[model samples]
Target: MSGQAARNVLWIMCDQLRWDYLSCYGHPRLRTPNIDRLAAEGVRFDNAFVQGPVCGPSRMSYYTGRYVTSHGAVWNFVPMSVGEMTLGDYLRPLGVRVAVAGKTHIEADRTGMQRLGIDPASAAGVLAAEGGFEPYDRDDGIWPPGFSDESHRYTQYLRKQGYGGANPWHDHANSALGASGEILSGWNMRYAGLPARVDEADAETPYMTRRAIEFIEQSGEQPWVLHLSYIKPHWPYVAPAPYHAMYSIDDVLAAKRVPRELENAHPVLQGFRQAEVSRNFSCDHVRETVVPTYMGLIKQVDDQLGVLFDYLRRSGRDQDTMVIFCSDHGDYLGDHYLGEKELFHDCVTKVPLIIRLPGAGARRGAVESRLVEAIDLVPTILDAMGADIPDHILEGRSLLPLLRGAQPAGWRPAVFSENNYAFRDFVREPLGRPADGCHTIMVRDHEWKYVHFEGLRPQLFNLRADPEEFDDLGADPAHAPIRERYQTMLFDWLRNRKIHPTVSHAAMTEWTRKEESAGIHIGRW
Candidate 1:
């Protein structure tokens, strides 16, 4: 507490990793001893929601320390507004070294990155995008120039390792990557999760952790902020060796499968359950293979984490580094008939959040039931490092109060998440229909959830009576009052919010098709 406020912040983020998957949160099947240990070692927020269910927008929120709506990181593929302030901006002035690993959907252009103060020049790894690494190391094997898959390499790697499944929707074409022994340089051509299937010596995580350790080692004396984002337990359901065989479907149980009336409640959630229903997963190959494979992948990540932790401890930085474990977003791995992430269910929106503060007499092993959002990470880190809060950033609050065991007044007991079905131009598969024209926005209190699907009918659930959100109160006359209350709140939300206009829906669809179109990048070029 006496030294300068600069502390080494290691942000460990997982892709499509859910909150409930960790054993600390009442899941008996998911073996997350590392997360469980982290929960025990620090504070775990029971109700932590993400800014958005998808990656890009959520990552943007993480960078700016603001929610999607406020930060204007509206959807996937949209460049984060360069003019806006960022966590890097705050930290750089405070003498902190900011570095990113796995993913950064941050400002797409050079101007944006520089403006936000993201030191891409100092980045240890920038997997997909070019220009992140300066002096270049070809031996790294983490990336090949013009290599375009922006996410989930480990899962794709595992699928090629004998974890075969069909793309019945014909939506997946990367299955051939394994057969040909030819790696597809682009995003859709190669399964994103496949990279994790490599051996420990060659795998991405070990390499990444090694890089983290190396960065820390090289810093003879510098306050570093390392964002270690791991892509695992994601899609393609492909896991490697013992991990690909770790647990069985018997070992992995299903989430609460409620009735289907309230199911149609959100168009943002349409095609969700069916999308999860793969004729492949949960079958013999799946039960004996897929589930265990995912567990194996998770454990693989955990092992690397343990390695990174060991490095920190051995270097005497254990108490000096404030570690945080979280995820960009959660996945719907067969939950509600969804294969990947599109639905706004708790399964995909609620993420594991553990914050470990480094200081004498700082509270440890405290589990706070307060609701928190992923967007809060930026400000929290900044506050922890004693940085100034730029007045323009307004979506999230500093959690210094909660960490200090003081629940300050005026704290909203709810968290919000909004995702436009039409705006995610960069991602394929979770197709969006204009007629459906669904816009989903959620406001959840401790015991209730208010879900508004703009063009479709709304959904209201009493989490106290139906934790599964099975019973819809929106249509019931008896609950009409509650609906009105939520509706008013939704309006109030709009009143205080600024909705950034994006490229039209047609523009989005056109871009998506072109980007995924057999090497297509533009229309009528």
Candidate 2:
């Protein structure tokens, strides 16, 4: 095996961050200098999309390097099958220690473990959780009562720091202190204006940063992949003291929507707009009050990233480490009359993807607009590490060639994203169709985007003409050819390809031979 100079990988993912929110990505008011610096010194992918728009399945794709359908974890809380392989399962055997310092959103395959007679509380089970990443510090980012005990470590750390409460994650990290010293929980969006109860340093983003730095500092003698995931700019928009007040209402961007977008909406989307998360952004007052805090949260993440980058340089590991910055998915943030991501809009699917290699000075500050998917990260990292790419198991192609400033011939012409909102109970809409009918697929190329819902009308936008996606031409007969072309593409994209190919080629060959040698084929003959 050839030893790669970029042995260490720092995979950082920010939750619910929009692609355009960063200064490098053309956010006019929000100045993300640290993240922008990554763009300045690395390869920035202008059009990187996630396989799934929601947290769980999106992250499953990132961790497993497979699509939601292939992994069998199509929605939040759905367990990835134990038979499936993960990044750790592939990398750890090659002497690379894969560890996560933050959320993976990976649900453990408890049924598989139980059937296999593996103790769920054992070290093996914990490692088996989310593709077998050794938890340097795993926080799933949900801290409500009974939501998860894995996050109790963070709560305990907060208690040690004098953040007292039954659930310190809610009280200190998520809540604000009113003038009367009462807890103003972040659940109330109106309270987003108030500063968080905890100090800025003790907030979730900084805390996760510190934990990641500690992991890097102590990961002695082993070439490792450290996933530093941040749950900022996701929700509970209140930031701590200084960050909370960093931006004012005036800094908030106008909602990216037109009044006419409501015309001819799909049933799935009609239900999405009425969902609690989506409805919150519909109020103009909520948009104005909460957006600044959202910006502050992003700024806080950027500042912490600065700390992380500085630490790498000071530790003298900057030259041998690969730093990748992206998000699981983007936030709608009131775009298209929606708030949270579940739709196929650019604001929800297109994420900021910046990759900084250790010695990629030749292509430094270069930008690649070729269509890329979040699933591509795994193969790319493995290739960068000089490990064998598992061609049969992984569906994404490596971006190493693109990173080296070489354009491969015959790259994918379009990108795709999917969502299964119908299975989710949070969306309590009576769409008259079964849960499977709520599935939606999006196929987008350079100029047009086509969204197909199983039971509702399709949506097509001439992206070149309507960048904001204000006009839906699915109903226009003039665009029939365009719609048909994209429909064929989508159909061909999801055609009868293997979703489960667990057995190796040699094993399959042996099994087929054995079956043939036996009298199994005699009756058929």
Candidate 3:
């Protein structure tokens, strides 16, 4: 096994997480017993998705597998520049090592020397700025030097899971964890005043699974790859203590979304879908106050991913290890009325695709509906260690043939998701403003879903007769030729790909006033 490559390539990843709240995507209640035991030991992909439904263009489509408008990295710190190419610049020139821990946002913030779009070998020569977007109005050097950016970093990892204050990352949301960071154990929370946590053997999702089992017990021979990354179910949804009473937020369900999905749909889910249901996103007020706070942060990230896969199956190394758990996008808690999620819907572009290729060639517990994408996870993690996959910037196509169970040998007809919200005022620069930005181009494939809207109005769902897309067959009259054959398959998928910096016609009309630029403006999608 060591000769075939993967001496180590863990790769976890989460943040804003949501792929139907786990329990192996059935959700019914969202317990996520260590991602349902790594989807019962690996290979779970029921139509995975995420290439920018938010969060730095889906981490620049898994470090450049392309599409986010031909990878200009379109918005959110716009980095990933300087001669793009990374899977950590292709596995640190092959000897591999790599590393990467939690939330590595693609690009933003650059000090003089001009050349911004990042990727000057994705830094580590000591570069800072890791999450919790600062305040007192962020942006002069984006978030560091923080005096206050008005909470968030799960409101300082949930007031450091209420373990007394002393700086639960600078306290304040009514400041009071009296003790001092370190109690928060697991499973507790019915609600009311709610404050008793600190125990899941001292949180921070098992302190980054004890630094990924001490980086695989200090990788002493080399050939590693790590990439941990796990911000957790996302949001102030605290956890620790029986995964904050493991799922009981009024029984949890919600997330369906079809009800006419707001007429003239898909201009990025038109006005963020919401026609009938309200009451601040019902379902018993997001299951008793926002899904018992996102299943108490996804049951403390399924008990630190079962303490790093039970310390890689009790150090036997579970067949030279090759686990993967995804999610860089997804979070639409109240669904339609919405909470967070740049809205592409599927509760924010699907997500949650497990993979664990160890012995007996993966798929042990099974479940793979296909359609995967997060830029096909760095070419199915360089073809699960057989490595060697390179054709330069591959736009994604190596799921190791659907983890070798065979399918998708030539798959993908509709596996794309885009975003460029007026590039979030250079991603929150001076707090940003210009608005009106919209540019979604979904394609769904099987079971009819066409969502095409550069400016607005163009949707045609039938996810098996409205799986909550309610019904906006664009302007039905008998679904006018299934909306012109998915608008010529979204215009031959943008005329056979290729875009970066190409948005021009007087700069797309000084920022989409479109009809071909009428004003001297300069902003919007």
**Count of residue pairs whose backbone atoms collide, per candidate:** 23, 0, 38
Candidate 3: regions farther than 4 A off: 1-12, 15-197, 227-231, 234-238, 241-284, 291-329, 337-347, 350-373, 380-387, 390-414, 417-482, 485-525
Which candidate, 1 or 3, has the higher TM-score? 1
Q: Model 2 over residues 1-525: C-alpha lDDT tens digits?
A: 485738799999998899999999998999999999998888999999998899988888888778777787888888898878888988888899899888888888999999998887788788886568898888875556535353457877888899776788888789998888888889888988889999888998999999998998898768999999888888878889898888888898889888888987766677788877778898788888898899999999999999999999999878888899999998887888898887898998899999988884337888899999998999989988989877768878888888878869999898888888777555535767677677788999999999988867799999998999999898899999999999999999887334656756567669867888885785673
Question: Which 10-residue window in model 2 sums to the lowest lDDT?
Answer: 143-152
Q: How accurate locally is residue 263 in candidate 1, as Cα lDDT from 0 to 100? A: 50
Q: What lDDT score goes with residue 202 in model 3?
A: 51
Report the lDDT tens digits of candidate 3 across residue range 1-525. Answer: 333524567878788877877777887765677788877877788888887787787877776677787766665666655445557656665676666655567453344214444342344322322221111111111132234433434335444556334433223221113346533321212231243344556555665667667767777677677777766665445554565565565666655554445445433333343322233453554456557657667767777787777777888776776778888888776666555776566767888878877766545678888677888778777777666555445678777656657654567767778775664332323323245444666778558777765545566778887765666676677888988888887788777663433333345445645533665555646
Candidate lDDT values, in order = 0.62, 0.85, 0.61
Q: Give residue 324's error in model 3 in angstroms.
A: 12
- Candidates in order, TM-scores: namely 0.77, 0.94, 0.33
Clashes of 1: 23
Q: Mind sharing the TM-score for model 2?
A: 0.94
Candidate 1 least-lDDT 10 residues: 167-176
